[model samples]
Target: MPDRIEQAKRALRADLRERRQIVSSQTRDAAEAGIKEQLDALVDRLGARSISCFLSTPTEPGTHAFVTAAVARGIRVLLPITREDGLLDWSVATPETEIAEGLFGLPEPVGDVLGPIAVNDVDLLVIPAAAVDRHGMRLGWGRGYFDKTLGSMEKCPPVYAVIFDSEFVDDVPRDVHDQPVTGVVTPTRTIALASHHA
Candidate 1:
């Protein structure tokens, strides 16, 4: 049964990946702008002085503008660095920080590496997602990176997954190890969903 669920997730993610890649540069630019505004507003609404967020891939909803803007606003932002052990290391994103491709080819920050525990101090977490159901169940890219991090945290803040508006769906495959997010941040709006874990 679990294998079948995993298969379903893979199929859905493949479709999402294709769709993301096909998005026009013009549309992508508009999306990034909207995402930046929504994220900024979310930070103000949550009063998140420090936050952990991923450096989005080209296909994903872009967070680069928000990260840059956040640092300029004096908000401490931590970017994820993937580790060989399947855990995420973190680095503080300074204006001068450079991004390099990670082990998985995911864009990661180039800086002094901080252990996974560095994320514990964050006031909020904004992560990438292929899609999110109304109930806040997230379909990740199947690497289980975000899943492991969220599960290991002793005290988790409001975790919001960044996704395109069309990616907000009715439901997604949920494995036992999967973690639900507090809400989703899309290009159009930031919404709070009722997550069992939240």
Candidate 2:
């Protein structure tokens, strides 16, 4: 059954990837600006002083502006550093932090590496997603990095997945190890899914 679920996810991800690639530059710019605004408002709404956010890849809804602005605002932002062992290390983000291509060609920060457990202290987690369902089931980009990180947390914070406005769906295939997020942040709005309080 899990295999079937994974297969469905694979097919869905392929379609989503193609969709992202075709987003016009004009739309992309507006989306990025909107995403940054939503993220900033989310931070203020939650009163989060420290958070973890992923550096966006070019095709993903841009988080680069948000990350940079957050650092300048004196918020502690931890960026994910992919490790070979299928776990994530982290790095604190600053205006001076340099980005380099990491595992799977993902954008990662170059700096002092903080171990996996470093994320436990964060007040919020803003992560990547290929798509997320209304119930908060996130379809990641065929990688288990975020799932593993989220599942192992002792006391997970208000984890939110970042995606384009159209990536939110009514349902998605999920397996036992799949973790539901507290909410989702899209280019246009933020949704605190009901399951966040479950």
Candidate 3:
């Protein structure tokens, strides 16, 4: 049986997911463009030569455009290839990298598989989240993949969660297993939270 906190988190995650699912195509497109712009600014600010990114699905705040653009600019882009154990294996995501059906029906890189700690080689890390709070606590998609990854990093690079502006909230339930992000990048705003936990 799950704890009360986990149960509450599941409810919240479900609600937030439903909200994301209803976003219109035009709105999603506009948000995607805005997110790409903000992401570019973040890359410039961090001077990140190599970064870990995700390939977004259509409904999520888009990362596809930003990933491709970053690669074209000579930035090394690492994308996650989910493994059966719920930990991520890293791979270089190029414009030509083959996209194949991956775990959870998401598109994943079909390139050389780098081990889990491959993320440590990057200067910055960007990940997906269902919601984020002002305190930097993130609500993930009820799976512990990223939480495990971030928790195990000895020296994690600056981590940011890509989310829609509306999904940025004041309160998100967190437990010992939950991981806090360094910041959140929304389409219209870039919010940097004070250090809590990486």
Candidate 4:
């Protein structure tokens, strides 16, 4: 029998595939609004200076609104760079920074790449996900980029999965190595999960 994580992943992949195919402009607008509201609330709750979030891409849910809100609040922003051997390095993004196409057509910074910082330094991490559950489990695009990078961190930041409200579910299949998030942000509201391990 497939484990819980496997089942959830399969379901989520199907949902995301369907969503990708027929995402109407109206749907996109609504999702953007919802994401913006939740992000504003989150930033307010955890002051701007205390958060460091990853810049999102257009193909992913909650991309533009989240980044715009973060930037407007003067919160520090970081974008992931695909490094040698499939590793990810994050560098700060500024107003004048130019981005070039990187691995998988992802946008990366054109300025000097910053060295890796301790996860503890980031009070909150807004991660993009295909799907997220109420329990904070996330299903990524299966490249293992986030799992690998986050796995090596000495102190994991408060990871929060950013998704459309429809992408939030009751459960998702999780494996031993799958890192669970502390919360999920959707267009509607922020779903907080009680720390499962502590």
Candidate 5:
């Protein structure tokens, strides 16, 4: 299963890079707008208070529109930092917050590290994935950061994996360490209440 997942991840990564290369700036702009609309609707429905999400790195799908919308709604927005052991820790983000490069070249908050908060403290968690199945199982970039972090959470938040529509699948190889999401959101729609416990 791990080998299969690795192959799938490689394929998906190549596909994404190729697609990004050919994608016109105009198309990307339009996609960003569509994604914003879907995410805004999902955020409203979820009614999250304190939310933990990722800042978009170039290869990822999300537009960061959800983060902006959350801030606009006065929800406490948090970002993840890759810890030394490949685990993730959360820190708060405000409009004026400064970010610095962290592991894997991801930008994270530069202010005082607030450390990990209880998962239950977060009403919603916008998760990043390379691909996700209808069953809510997610395939990340083969780093167990999210799995480790989610496992340590006392109370799991409502997890939502963000992906491009084409990246949503009917099945994906899962392992004991793989963390599942509660739902998935794409540019066109949000599939609600998808259980990851299958």
Candidate 6:
């Protein structure tokens, strides 16, 4: 059953990736503008003084503006640094922070490596996802890095997955290790999940 489910996830990931690749830069920029505005509102609603977030790649829903803007507003921001052992380290992200290519070709912060427990300090977490289901189950990249991180948290903050407007769907494959998010922030709306664990 797990194998079949994982196979389905692989197929879905391929499809989503292809869809993202075909989006014009202009459309993506427009979507990102809306997303940034929505994220700012979410932060205020949650009173999230500290946030853990990912630096998005070009093809993903752009988080570049949101991260920088949040930092400028004096919100404490932490960005992940992929480690070789599949665990993620974190570092404080400022507009001036130096970045370098890290694992999985992600732009990682270059400075002191705050270990995984750094996540416990955040009031909210905004993670990257390929897609999110109506139930808030997030389909992440196959690496399981975020899954492992969430699984280890004893008292997680409100975790939200950031996805494009079209990526929210009716269902996504689930495994025992998969953690559902509290909500999804799309370009057009913020959908709070009934299945939110925290």
Best by lDDT: 1
lDDT of 2 by residue, 1-198 (tens): 888998999999999999999999888888889999999999999899999999988899999999999999999999999989999999999889999999989899999999999999999999999889988898998779999999999998999999987899998889887899989998899999876433
Residue-level lDDT of model 3, residues 128-168, one tens digit each, is 99999999999998878899999989888889999999999
Q: What TM-score would candidate 3 get against the native?
A: 0.96
lDDT of 1 by residue, 1-198 (tens): 999999999999999999999999888888899999999999999899999999988888889999999999999999999998989999999999999999999999999999999999999999999999998999999889999999999999999999999999999999999999999999999999998656
> For model 6, how does the per-residue alpha-carbon lDDT over 104-187 read when each residue is reduced to its tens digit?
898888987899999999998899999999888999988998999988998888899999989999999999999899999888
Better by TM-score, candidate 5 or 2: 2
- The estimated TM-scores of all candidates read 0.98, 0.98, 0.96, 0.84, 0.87, 0.97
Q: Show model 4 residue runs off by greater than 4 Å.
A: 1-11, 48-50, 118-120
* Model 6 regions lying over 4 Å from their true place: none
Arranged by TM-score with the best first, the candidates are 1, 2, 6, 3, 5, 4
lDDT of 2: 0.92
Write the residue-wise lDDT of candidate 4 on 27-128 in tens digits: 777877887788778877876464545555565554655665576668777767777676677776666667788887776677767655533466677777
Where does the lowest 10-residue lDDT sum fall in candidate 6? Answer: 189-198
The predicted structure with the larger TM-score, 4 or 5, is: 5
For residue 101, what is the lDDT in candidate 5?
A: 87
Instruction: For model 2, name the residue pairs that clash.
Output: none
lDDT of prediction 6: 0.91
What does candidate 5's lDDT look like per residue over 30-146, in tens digits? 666777787777677777778888886665565566677777779898888888877677777777778788887887777657666544488778878877887788877777788
Clashing pairs in 3: none
- lDDT for model 5: 0.74
